[model samples]
Structures are given as structure tokens and as C-alpha cells.
Target: MNEDKNRIVSHGAFVVRYRAAGAYRFEAHSHPYLTVTSVMSGMLEAEIGSSHLVAAPEESLFTNSFQSHSGNGSDLEFVSVGITAEAVAEAAINAGFTKAGADIAFNNSYSSDRSVAEIARAIAAEVLSEEPGRNAMLDALISQLVIVLLRSHLRVKRSPLIELSRAGPVDRRLRRAMEFMHDNYSRDLGIEEIAQAAYLSEYHFARLFRRVTGVTPHAYLANLRLEQARELLINTGESISDIAGAVGYQSQSHFTKAFKAVTGLTPKSYREGTTRAVEPAEAGKAGLESSNKVSSGE
Candidate 1:
């Protein structure tokens, strides 16, 4: 099946596009750049190697350069964005990494990632809607998708943090609240208080906060709290419960869960001078390199 020509939107750095609905299958083809794809509906069967990875609704896939992959599904509605090899290499340089980092691969073919899938949906929606600012919207969403892909799927260094202009009028409103969050994360703070800090209503504050920071206020606050808690853990001799309370968590268990989510260690493990546990580099361990047989799939 051919893709909808109207669905393709390209900026020099990236491309946001989607396939038209019909019987869909690929008899093993490969591209020269990175292709990140998402299946909005229908099941996609991907043969990565000896295993067949299935991508269902809201699941995305990553294919590395020159990796042969094929898919089979009926009436599959999906969106994909490709980062050109030159663009990927340039992003690596911008992030202070070697050019080779841009050619990274995914350990798993299908990812049930909310952020990646949502970006794809948003790009597709903007494409189909013929929105007034379609190019800008698509560029923003596609850029975010690239960041998520590099961090989560490729496990590269997260060097290029958000760097939008705080001088913008809308962004100026959030600067004070951002500072407030940084200073007061260890208090019993909520969105209402943060919005009050910015003199914005909660809904408006939430929308603008995410628009500026690429995360919700609550998430940003939680990250700040966790970072502070880690500093205290490493530098001080405070008890776990004291640290939890100081970090604004009402209960130690909740704080522990949040800490582990970010650091991969419980408070006790962290404070006792234990190194963070490493996720088994299963794919790398298995010598899952690009080859004639092992193909990274999308």
C-alpha cells in the first residue's frame, strides 16, 4: 500500500508522515536512516530475529540504519517519523556526543510508550486536520519524539535538555513558578500553590508549564525533590524517614517508590553507599549487532 502523500511533513532535520489504510506488509526492505514508527490500531507482526515481535495499538517501533524489517497487518493505521542520517549525526554533535551515537539501535522492537505514541498521534492529527500551524506543530512533536527515542530506546546521553526561550511572554509567566518549584519542592506544595506563584489559573499553568518544560509541573517538582533527596542521601547522615519528610513525601513508602523509579535504588540501598543496579544489557550481551540475520524492526 502507498502512503497518503498529504501526510508527509518535512523539516530539514526530521520528517513526520503516516501510511494510508489498507492491507499492509513489507517483504523485507531497509532504509539508510532511523525510522521510528507507531501503530495506532491493528496488530503489526515484526520479525526481528528468531523472535516475532508484535506491535499493537499505541505501541511504537524503532528501526536502525540499514536494518531490514517487514510488517504484516490489515487496515493498519500508523504514523512514523524518520531522522535522516545527517540530521542524527548533527544532533549527536549538538548533544556533545560522538557522531556514532546517532546510529544507535533499539533492544526491543515494539515499545508501549505513552509519550512516543502520543507524539505520533498528535502529528497525524495535525496532518489530517490541515491545521493553520501544521508545520510548526509537526516540527515540535517530531522533535520531542526524537528526544524520547534517543533517551529511552537508544539509551544515549541526555545532554540536550529543554532550551526554549524564557523571554517569551508566555514563558516569562512560568519562570517564577519554575524557581518556586526548585526552591520549595521539599514542602507540601501542589498545583494550586504553584499556579498561585505564577499568578495563573491551574489549568492555564499546567498547559503552559508543559509547553515550556516538556513535563507537567507535578513531574518536574517530583524530579526536583528526588534530586534534592539524593544530595541529602549522599552528603548527610539523615535517616530515610527524615529524608522522605524533608522531600515533601507524606510517607516513606511513596518516596521510596519515586526514588527507585528514578535511581533504581531504594532509599536504604542508596544511603548505604550501594551503587545503582544496572539493567541487564540483554541485547548487547547477546551480541545483537546489525547483521544479515538480526534486524532491528519497525
Candidate 2:
């Protein structure tokens, strides 16, 4: 048995728990074996091949052997277990199955099956527990997990792939660019500045940023800033121009236009609609006086 800060490992099965704030992201990667990822709280967004989906609490995701997947999430907490194909392959080799294909593969990328989710969560909990003899307990649970995966997750209905393709992690340059935006969304930013932060040429960085996020850096930053603007609008009595400048927009007119474009309502209307009981003037401030903020000062 092996243990780490938030993980446990033994023959055939290894489990790990993840709990974090902000956003949790990983460039594209895959396990050398089959994996079951379960959401315990918040949400998990993943991309498997061409499919994009979100897993909520008590929901689970399954992946085939060597299946390529990438994802990111905010305020996420989840647990995952990987069933090692190398271990099984070694055992098969020792048993003289050098020519036999004894490793298993799963078909589905996502599962809401209560039984599977329950089992995955239980395994997660067991690995994270400090109780006695957990190594032995894990052995028993993993045996059962194999049965469950075979019974429910492994699909025989569809033709199986002969080999799954592997993709490299999201470029480090892109990660740097993303972090830059998160830190500097309130400042006037340009593609040239963001690309320089990533240490890449403007044209190269632009293409890769769009390829990874499906949006140009400008659009991405705009969306992020707008999201922050929405939060400020709902949670505080910051003036429209204050909120606009705080999130990188130089002009109130442009901010209003862009905010309305993404949120389907003008900033004033959104603030009013969200805080229905409050006076419209109090709900939508047009002044920059922090001491006169309605949400807190009143």
C-alpha cells in the first residue's frame, strides 16, 4: 500500500481525492488504465473526444483505456480511481497469456448510474479515511468495483476502438495566457500583451488560444470581465461606470453594450430585476462614491 496527501494506492486500484477553490484545470491527458471520476460537490466539466458535458454531485464519468480527456472546473471537489491495466497485463503475462488480450475497456464517457456513483464515492471516502485496515478494505471494495464496471460501464453494444488516440497537455503558453487574464481582467489588455505574457508570437498565441478555448483572447477576457461585472452588479451597488472600469472596459457605452450582449439585459435592468424589492435608483448606482454604496452603506 502507498499513501500521499490525498491519495491511496495498492495493487490494481488507486484512488485520490481533490478539493480546491477557484478553478481546477488540467491540460489534456489520459490514464494508462480505466478511470472512474465522480463529483462530490460543485460541478465538473469535461471534454471526451467530441463530447462536452458537466457532471454534478453524485454523478460520475467513465473513461476507456487510454481515453484522451481534458477539463476545468470552478469550486470543484471530486474523487477518482484508476484501475491499472499494466498490473493486469503483468499478471496475464505471468500466466502465459502473452498473445491474449486480457485488458478491459469501458465504452461510456459519462454515467449517472446511482449504483456506480455510490460505489465510486464510497471508494473515494474509503481511500481518504483514517480508519484501520483500510488497505484490506480497499482490496475488497476494488474487487467489487471491477464487477460493477464490467456490469454497468463496459458496453458491448457498440464496436470498440482498436486503439485510442492520445493528446498532449494544453500548451504551457496557453496556461500562462489564461492565468494572465484571470489576474489582469480588470486592466485594459490586448492580444499583443497577452501573447507576450505567454512568451509566444501574436499570431501563434491567437490561434492556439482560440483552438483551446473556442474564443479569441479578447472574447475570453471580455466574457470573464463581464462575468465579474455581473457579480458586482448583483452583489454591490457599484456604479455602472465603476463596475465597467473595474473589469477593463474603458467606456460605459461599450460596457453596457457588451454586458447586454452576453447577459441578455442591460446592466440597470439586470440589477433591477435581480433586486426587485430595492428602489431602482438604489439598485443601479450611477455614481462612483464607495461610501454611498447601497448594498453595504445602507
Candidate 3:
């Protein structure tokens, strides 16, 4: 895939474009760019790692950097606009979302005929016009697209079935224990160490931890390690033994057992299950090297 060809138009910081033709099949790939696709006149299906969704005319989708997926249009007219990943991250931070997890992957299919057709017409008008402030015009249109999709996305409300009005003594202790566990999951951890981290006796900490998170501290640690291991397995070429050690498992077998227990697949199997190659333009720009530095507090 040609990164330059993928980039349609760059307005200040955001790049925008549309897709209409081409076969509906692409290998799994990732980029350091942000992507927002507005289905103009046909249906498109996308696979993000293990997740899948479909978008119809006037519907939209958003993806963040290094997201692995493949897509194709069902009919002829399918197009999408993309922005750089850095811009989206900056927007997320501005929106007060700190731990901006993975890319925001979602899709919306139009249920009402009139609405879908109207949005498609609107998109076509915008794409064809060479009016002044066209870039800004596209930005506004994309923003509206995001709003429409988000309004359709389902968000489950926290259960009112159980409520905690105030932090009880047990709750306070458990909260502390959870914080310690999150901060120390990469290290060689123990129940005793975690209890001490929370200033609680071992027995009390173990019981309370289970009550809050629905899992024992040790079990929770194992889950965290597995998640970290999976991330490394998919994103990096680190050896299995090294990844196991880095995430706190002393033995490769132990890590493999726990990983399979949680994810239902061995580490190697999970990695190979979705072997997405990066596009050359994206790969060339990859890495974490910083060109400039500034001094911190004295």
C-alpha cells in the first residue's frame, strides 16, 4: 500500500479523502495515522483485529494509530477520509481523556432511508465543491459525522442494583490494594507484598480484593500479566521467553498456561492469528525517537 496515495488532502494537520472504487479486500495493516471513513453511497465492512463492523451510506467510522484491519466496499461507491493519528491523540487529550487506550473503533449503519440519502447527498456536495475554506468545511462535516455515529453507539449504564454511597473501611483498603496491584503488576508480586502495599493483613486484603474486583489479587495479577503479554506479542517481535519474563512470569510454561487460561489461545497462536503487516510509509515513520528536548523543573 502506498502511504502517499492513501493521503488525499492535508488541511493544516488533518488529512481528508474519500474512497469509491477498488476490490473490497486488503491484508491486515496498521498505520501511525488516524482514519475516519464516511460511507458515501454503498456498504463497507471492516475488521479491526478480532472486532468487526459494517458501515452503510452516510455512516462513519473512526480508528486510531496502529490499528490493524482490512476492508472493502460491497458495491462500487465507497469512500473514506483519514486524519493523522497525532492529531486525534491531541484532540483526545484536549477532551480530558488521559489514558486514551487503543484506537476508537466503531461503525454506524443507517436505519432510516431519508436520513441516509440526505447525508450522502450532503457528503457529495462537500466533496465536489471548490469553495473557500473547503478544508474547514470538510472538518465540520466530519465532526458532524462523528456526532451522529456516537449518538447511535450503545453505552451500558452502571447497575443501580448495587451502590456504594461512601467508601467503607474495607472499600478504602481494597482500593489501595487495587492501586498497588496496577502499579506493580510488571514486577515479581506476591499477596503478602500487595497486603503490605495496602497496609492490610494478608487474609483481610485477599478477601476484600476479591469482593471488589471479582477476583483474588493473585488472579487479577495473572490477568494483567496476560493482557500485557498479548499486547507485546501482537505489537512487537519480542521473543516469547523475554515477554514472559518482562511481565513477571518466571517460567515460559507458567506464562503460556496463564495466557491460554484467560485468552483461550497460546501466546504464539494469538500473535499469528492476526499477522497484520504495516504499510511501508507507516513503517518508515514508526519508532519513538524524539528530535528535540526541553528542561524540566529544578
Model 2: residues >4 Å from true position, as ranges? 1-17, 86-103, 156-298
Best by lDDT: 1
Q: Give TM per candidate.
A: 0.47, 0.46, 0.39
Q: What is the lDDT of residue 234 in candidate 1?
A: 54
Candidate achieving the largest TM-score: 1
Poorest 10 consecutive residues by lDDT, candidate 2: 289-298
Residues 60-97 of candidate 2: C-alpha lDDT, one tens digit per residue: 88875445577877766677766655433333345443
The residue ranges of model 3 lying beyond 4 angstroms of the native Cα positions read: 1-175, 273-298
The weakest ten consecutive residues by lDDT in model 3 span 289-298
User: For model 3, which pairs clash?
Assistant: 19-78, 19-79, 19-80, 24-72, 34-85
Query: Candidate 2, 127: how far from true, in Å?
Result: 1.9
Candidate 3 residue lDDT tens string, 32-124: 344555565667777765568787765655554345556655443533444443444344445443333323333422233344345544654
How well is each residue in 1-298 modelled by candidate 1, as lDDT tens digits?
A: 4342224443334545566555566544444347878888777777643357888889988875445566677667787776765555455556665533222455666689998889888877875653354444555676677677766776443323322232111135576787787678788888999999889999999998776554577766766677567656655678999999998999999998877654334677656622211123322222111110100111
Model 3 clash tally, residue pairs: 5
